[model samples]
Target chain A: MYLLRRGDPTMFETFWRGPIGESATLVIPGYQTMSYFSDVGNLCWFLEPGFEREVRRLHSLVGNAAVEGYHVLVGTGSSQLFQAALYALALPTANAPVSVVSTTPFYSMYPPLTDFLNSGLYRWAGDANAFDGDDYIEVICSPNNPDGSIREAVLKSKSGKDIHDLAYYWPQYTPITHMLAHDIMLFTVSKCTGHAGTRIGWALVKDKEVAQKMSKFMEQSTIGVSKDAQLRAAKVLGAVTDGYEHQLAAAAGGDANLLFHYARRKMAHRWCALRAAVAASGIFSLPNEVAGFCTFTKDTVTSNPAFAWLRCEKQEVEDLESFLRENKIITRSGTKFGADQKVVRISMVDTDEAFGIFVNRLATIK
Target chain B: MYLLRRGDPTMFETFWRGPIGESATLVIPGYQTMSYFSDVGNLCWFLEPGFEREVRRLHSLVGNAAVEGYHVLVGTGSSQLFQAALYALALPTANAPVSVVSTTPFYSMYPPLTDFLNSGLYRWAGDANAFDGDDYIEVICSPNNPDGSIREAVLKSKSGKDIHDLAYYWPQYTPITHMLAHDIMLFTVSKCTGHAGTRIGWALVKDKEVAQKMSKFMEQSTIGVSKDAQLRAAKVLGAVTDGYEHQLAAAAGGDANLLFHYARRKMAHRWCALRAAVAASGIFSLPNEVAGFCTFTKDTVTSNPAFAWLRCEKQEVEDLESFLRENKIITRSGTKFGADQKVVRISMVDTDEAFGIFVNRLATIK
Candidate 1:
């Protein structure tokens, strides 16, 4: 019911909704991958070797992240990985819970999730820019959620650490401006290939101690991530790379089978449609468009974010989400993102039909 | 390295190590189940409808659990569901964290996992029998881990709650004593089908509000269980039911394709071998074997537990785990389960070769 009322990240469904043969299908026999330990010798004991290999291969192909020296740790999702990172960075012997801060208009779930357990190891300290504490863990979500702005860690305290949520750093959402080499970087198959139900996410950690600590947290929490999901994710990601390699071999400049190319085109079209609707409405405004030279794409490409941060121009429209709901649309209020209520975050990743209806409702809202 | 020194439940691998054709296989297409939401109308929005159906069907078939009028909430594993139950039962508005207790000789992972996050919501207070708190959560692991003792909640305080860990309460490990209708009963596919790597677990929650709270905790932790794993678990469980149905149609009483029958036979044989070895050794003792009339199998059968609670008879052998290590037979010390140091938990569910070697080593020990 909640999904019917709101648009989650189902936008990429349009591209892969139809039958595409066995390009990315996964087949598992009755007697395979039944053990809990995938690679016991590896630091992340539960991580499947095949999954790890595909993850590194995809990242290397996209040139989005540095995976050479990093240890890849799989989690149920980036959400689990985020908490694991916090657990890894927090000092167990500290007198007080370490403050976890992120910039305003951050991911709305961050605060609630961090404080959900009322954990003694860490607590949500909102707004990294406003955080005055010396001991803190700052999260930097590039091509940030809600606003689609590029970000970096604001607090540089000696005791402070950073967790880079690069969930949207893929070529379709944002340009691979550079190879991200951070202390801890997060990525997920949900945004990468729209396989949200797979619940497979990974982190590339620089420090072995932090990696082990995160893996320990995983062991304590979920035992480990699902091997079924990991194997499926590997297959899906492998298919994606196969598409690109196939295109490269043909040299036909046609991206009919390529996932990123197809997704990039769809996202670009949706962004254009949404921008036109917002401009024509005259009562709404969006963040100025940004572009960059993508190292992977080898071209200057416009940033097409997974979400649209829209602000109401009319003074009477204090709660934009409520206002949109009145117009038969739904959106998350910016208040949840630690921003003004007049601004709401609209997901641009809904199905093409849903996206069309949303834009039509927005254009006529005035 | 840790797994190398310990026997973790890998015994079921022998049954599933061979090709069983497509009986329990899972094939998923690239575009299938890409959305995060699965049966959003249900209390557990992330739960796949097919998975839920199979869970209920399997419970009815085994006559081991009451699934009607219950909300089945899935988790990463029973480990996650155990914590979820604790979270649901813990009063968030209370001034102090609720005490969590289990009987002595509890699952070894319970205490550390409960306290790992240093959660202010709940803390591990060992031994429910010794606990004197009015408001506490008691975990009852029937056909309990490490010791294989059938247990019941000892604490009946007015404000006390119970979470039944029925991971080993299956036809293979124990008889179908009754249809368990506890407030919250946890089970996992890892133990049920020996697909530990699938990492899928479910709880039959009796209360709506409690189920919702558990689902919320799941959302905050891992967002949701993996659809791929859930689908695979559903297929695997469905295959088990099919095996039994095939036998019923034939009316032959022969149980070749049935999973529980095969596993039960294997377990019973291993137990017989282990008992003979222990008796021959004359320096070790084991828990007395018990039996019950099983409704599922329609016969009185001897109890064959998944773990052997072995105690060294030698008074000088203070550390039994170290003693076993010297003999190249790895086992978990009873100290971890809050038991005497002279005893250790040996997994009876290992590969046939490994079990054969273990019993031989036991028989040779003075």
Candidate 2:
């Protein structure tokens, strides 16, 4: 059952509504994490050591990202970290603001978030593929948000900087191809453990100066992130890692009590249902399915993204989001992601009931 | 015993160290508050209803701020809310950035926080008293940060916007004279309940449009405040209010298990000790003590601010902070707060041990 409160029925749902059980849950005592400083000796003083340890352990367990020798700085979320990365990368002494670019069909928030302050430090420069600027910050979102495609940095300018948004790079969202060793990479518990409300994200920075600047930006922006959230995230991430460890000890039990396994299965099931719905509708199409050899799961797996990039084939559907809205469904417009109006991005991680309702509505659209 | 982590020895101390026992302790279950949305029906979509309810109740019980008609918007902290208020008040179409001015000897962070982004929407414009422009934003921190003096808006320009930072306005810091009905007033659990690590603050805004804009800024900046932190804040605030209610029923028993009463008594004792230390030092002077009749306490009370603004009377001590640093005590330089070099702001809310050490050091400074 969907435990939804009465409000905007059309509002997009988040992933954690499904039953993943109590292992990922956390209990924080009132007196815990009351001080602003978590580890005063660390460069990112606000970061809880336990959260950092869990983040490293999770990445190590999943074989997704390299954390060793990298500075771990916590943020409110990947959103704040994205801005912090921009702030850190931008040359303050420069005469003009640094241009920040991403590939088309980027996360809908990138543009507004970049340009919101009209900050002299950085400004949104659309489409990394079209940008020829030598000094620019390119965001590379792998297993990308809207399209769910594996990506690499498109801009190879010598003076260009890159901020790898690995928010969806976990084994559940995509294949664990290799240990990513980027200069700067962002991850969040929202996608990893479905704790979006925790507002916790961390960056693995290869450069100390950049990490310090990012930390400074956080200090200036919010006087650092919430320690309570960080503590909760630590507990949640620790539980997820523990589940994987338990699974490893019982390797023969294929779908044992593992968060990633459960999440991956759910995603796969959702994708199957969505594809079947679209085929039945005959008026909608989705991005081509991608699969790869898994390193962590030890089996070939089809990619199951957190979002379904759907394109309406009907010429009458001028605005897919509006058309869907008329049919008692809500979707983010492709135009928001710098794509054609005929396409809309549907979140695949919502509650099971919401997903079922969405698929049923889509199947009957014809 | 002080839990001093090995790090920067000169770093200033935070307040929550004294043993207040488990009354304010919160235990949050793991599965609770994982979504980004809290109260979708409210204008501030991310605000948890329980948090809002507790905030209103606390304000009503304390008679500090008028919250009846005001919109209570949650932020990562008052730091973020301060920026949000600035973002909300700044005119997008204005030819130049909105000038943000605080009085001389203001909070050390105000200037840097205001200008860090180099936002075209707002710029740090030194002291409000020196600012002659009609189009500006003025920040009023009552029972002010450095000097702990009761303050009013230094600039009364007809077009100027005011953001009342009432972070130190609680009964412990100062006497609650009346219910303050400001356009934008910011408060935080960091000061109110000694939960600096939670990074949770709420802004009581009178204007709907301004509140919405501030909320939008938060949405763009951090996506939203952490629900876990909000939940904890709600619990802490509720407990504080419960203590007051309990106190009223047991009025004959003074300082009876009330957080505010406990904090007030602690503050009173610390201030007395500090004053005695300064007098004994002969080379140091502190701001004049202020007192008023408190509506909540039902008695005349002296202001026991969170900070002791101390000035060095010794001619050799050009920099008071440096002088204190040599004495193995850390204090914020008055220069950072736009005051004279001889004046330094020392945090009075640190652990009893740290405060005791500080006072002893101060007394022997001569």
Candidate 3:
């Protein structure tokens, strides 16, 4: 008898739906009232009318060069658009062995989503070192998830056909225009607008057929992103662009300058704090800052943990996870991100206060 | 050369992303006032603590039922849940062939959604006039769309498997409990709480494996319905149920009595108007009144002779549709519904003023 299962019943179930019964609410220091839904919604509105208008205006401000066709189809959040693109392009045909190719240590969700969509029919070909055209479809996320490494332009696909997920190509990180030359460009309001809940994203595609197919797939898949979210996002995008323009107009000082100044100071403070904490413990080591995350390895002097710990083996990381969970501090293990058990990922997306709390907690780990 | 296509250039463009462009601003009447984002956000709260508290209170009021191992999974709208169930239950690998079986003259979206999901991979196995489980998945919608006929017991497979879609089983229509004894029970808030914009619906299944599979598919497909939408739906559901109970207490009447009273009164008014119109024409024939919609054939004669007094032929129905469009009225032609082209479906789901306008417009056809 085939007894049906209820829940995902897997170690990665949280990724499937997030901590089911836990309070994920957190209070950011400077940002008192942070609603992911509102932030994301504000970003969405710009994609509709306001953003489109701004893009046209930007073109005029820059030069007479036409904006690439691949830079248009924006969405509720990049996540929503990414899923739609997968459905639209990935057809489950015997002749067309649908395969997804992505560089290792990329955005964590890619492999799982690919697996879920595959339904055991297709699988992810995770070998960036030896990626080939036989993979059919390739997903590349620049300024990748954990390490935040941006692929240089020289690393183009051998077949010259690939879906470039430029999800993190904000002006602050990489030149946004540089990534627009790809056949598909994915951008999300979550990382840019700092609104993880609004769930809005977009894909700019040069191919009309691909765009139409993706749209159709989206319609069939989720029936489009929430209209309210999209409209709100458009509004936020307009406000941000306006702010950017005002900064540009200011003579000696502007919003852009102020933003850069603030970001630099904040990054320096956090980096120092992180460095001090790691050095004092002498148990964990981290590479230089990449994108929004810092990768860490365990120290050799420490007892070899079972899981992905600097000093411990793979099993120690799991034990450490249990220890952290008991203290209400949740950290993602490297295994979840398709990395060696010795490595763990920490997001720097949190505010100073939260980061401080996290740093302090880790400092006590020694 | 590979040409890149962008945007949807097809007739059945996906409608799941909420309305786009000018239509985005158009509020769906009665169902929801806030934009889709707000609705989704509100609905997502249901999955939160405060909202779950309310849900528990409501469950207590309704008495303890066996809800173990079954948790609610929401969708963009009931339309999405309907499609999800089809995807979950349909055999991925069938030997002879697999078909979707629905009663003739059922919810119109079923065939189209099935076709869209199938993408020419599978086809609907016409009405289950003969209950043969040799090659089909039987789909039955009680209190059906278009006709609104309530089926007491749907036809089951040879092995006793059944899929029941109870899209409309509110106190306003019929006293009904979801037929959970079946393999799957599909329900939606669009018809019940009237929150179409929330786009929240759920499927009740006895099989855990099926539920998990469907949930996994949905996570990758749409990444779980908008959290905001689910919470709002929970709020509406709680309030609506309370309102129904209060209304029932004030009237000192049971749900069936109230439902019968409203249904009979509305049916009488529409039937009277329709009968009078047909009597005056002396050449129109009407179907027996069983549900909210009725089919009528044109056979009237008039002296002005602009009356293209004709039989219900395929070409004539097409011509009538063009006529209606010209007058700024829209409707589903019989051809689209798999009905005889000579007969057109006239819906009573509109307001009285709209119905009056329709009557006046029909009078002009003479």
Candidate 4:
């Protein structure tokens, strides 16, 4: 039923719905790679140095984050990296399981992923403000997943290790206001290039041991990320950087920053349409957002986020997801995001047609 | 150095040296699938019933394993499946760590992977033969990684669960003497279709809860296997099965069993050459393998095996890998596989060019 309603304006697939086929499609050589090992900088499997070079080059150009003095470790996706970051930060050699915390309305994966292995190395201790702890892993999902809230580590523990998931910190998703130079920072092609199907993500780590351990975890798990995927990622990332140089003169009005500009405009347009829909419905409320000065754009820029965090306004109405589903609109319940049941998250990245249908249905939900 | 030696005659690189061009390549349709959460027959990610149908159909045509009364879960590779199997079999909820054991000269990954996370749920309990416990996971790697020996459960405890890794049970690597209907069976696209780089593998699991737990493990680790890879694997697997029906009748002398025939002959020829080389070396002893009744070929067929386990007969050649390295031939040491240092694993799957050089080097070693 879910598959049948894939684009029913009901399922808000937050992952990606971008250009594929020839543009993103990969035709791996018949005699292509198969080894879980690579000559990719003396690490574990699947990574090739050529591919890593391209990744490092892209980050350097984007200026969204610093890659220097960091071990570049790849994951099946940032979701895996999120788990790796926790695993690396919480040393088994430690006396007790490190407490993992984020502020309220955190990325849903954090708490569940932390406790999934049932491993005693780390425990999801809940809201950062409520938890009193020195040894903890503070996961900062800047330009956050569910609600599109930009945030800093709420916990002020000196002993806390911060894992900055910069998945949405790209110029297209959010303002590249600052160059992140955190201990452990994660970025993914899924959000940046909208190639979620590729399942390629990487982390830049300042600590050598933590980086090695993260890589070790990947090795024991999937051996490494897929080589075919890596090759595709390298190309896609190259194209993004190429867009920065306006390499495709025929596209984007010959603008140097084609990808970022196009994505930014598209996101902003979607946000406009979504806001108008919510306003017409008069049954939902949304939080206000502010833009930041972007280094890449050299201007104060704002982003219409990839998600619309919808909250029911009426006191009698709760179970926002169920409420929205009744109107043929699908959304993730706010409870999943550690918020109230009266709130739900509607994705802003679905196809234009689906988005139109969603806006129409949402407006009619009186 | 490893990348440079990719096509080196010393490296077998036999995993894949086949023709790869547009035909085998995949072009996922523009606006193709994304969303880590799939409606792929529930349970977990990367597994769509459409893809699972192809997998089961392939297995059925190959006469390799039983898929009935099983839950299909995909992973990054059989390596991940192996870890998942261990994790699923050893429930952390059981109040105590389950002893994970494999027989002597087991696949090198068993011990390290078992202990990687340092998870208290399971411990690497050395050799299976040495461990006497009911609650244990005994891994049986048929046509095992290091040495191509076919095997079964070394421990027969009532409370024990066995994970059968049939990675090399295909007719090309080993004779398909029987259809595996084990509790947990691990199979990979790498050895099967020589597409190891795709990082796709599946476990045919009999028990429902065990399969669900394994799916959960994959979910928390990589979220799921690469969907692109899964689609490609489905197509590649379909091609293999298509060859089984002689779908491309114009090729292979109208034989439906073209792939098997070609692969079998290639493996047999390689083995014949390998035998001659070892005989000429006069410093090594090779194990003798007999043919088994194969249902596919309808004959008592033998295998060339994917790996050559060579034992140094000379007293001076204690470190066989070092000795082979001195001769510009790279081989994995036997101690890595829990065997004597004098024994080393030589990959028999390298291309014809590399195999020839390896044969020449071994023949001249004395």
**Candidate with maximal DockQ:** 1
Q: Highest lDDT: which candidate?
A: 1
Write candidate 1's Cα lDDT for B33-101 as tens digits: 788899868889999999999999999999999999999999998999999999999999999999999
**Which residue runs does candidate 2 get wrong by more than 4 Å?**
A1-23, A250-256, B1-23, B250-256
What lDDT does each candidate get? 0.88, 0.84, 0.46, 0.74
Alpha carbon deviation, residue A269, candidate 4 (Å): 2.9
Number of clashing pairs, model 1?
3
Better of 2 and 4 by lDDT: 2
Q: Model 4, residue A163: what's the lDDT?
A: 88
Which tens-of-lDDT digit does each residue in A305-365 have in candidate 3?
A: 1011222233445444445545455656566566665566565545445567867776666
lDDT for each residue of candidate 4 in A109-198, tens digit (9 for 90 to 100):
787788766666888888787888688888888887777888898877677888898888888778888888988999887777666766
Model 1 TM-score, 2 decimals? 0.98
Top TM-score prediction, candidate number? 1
Tens digits of per-residue lDDT for model 2 on A109-182?
89999999999999998999889869999999998988999999999988999999999998878988888999
- Residue B117 in model 1: shift from native, Å? 0.5
Against the true structure, candidate 2 reaches a TM-score of: 0.95
Q: How accurate locally is residue A62 in candidate 4, as Cα lDDT from 0 to 100?
A: 78
The 10-residue segment of model 3 chain A with minimum total lDDT is: A1-10
Q: Which stretches of candidate 4 lie over 4 Å from their true place?
A: A1-23, A40-45, A68-70, A155-159, A247-257, A318-330, A364-366, B1-22, B37-45, B48-53, B68-70, B247-257, B315-330, B364-366
TM-score of chain B of each: 0.97, 0.93, 0.64, 0.91
Q: Candidate 4, residues B1-366: lDDT per residue as tens digits?
A: 011122112222332233322234565632344555556457765585556887898889778899877888888888888888887877767877788888888877788888766677888887888887678888888887667778888888788888898988888777788888988988888777667677888889898888888998887777677777777777667666666565545444532235566667777888888788888879988878767888877888776777888898998877888878888888778787788899887777656676777787788778
The clash count of every prediction, one per candidate, is: 3, 3, 71, 8
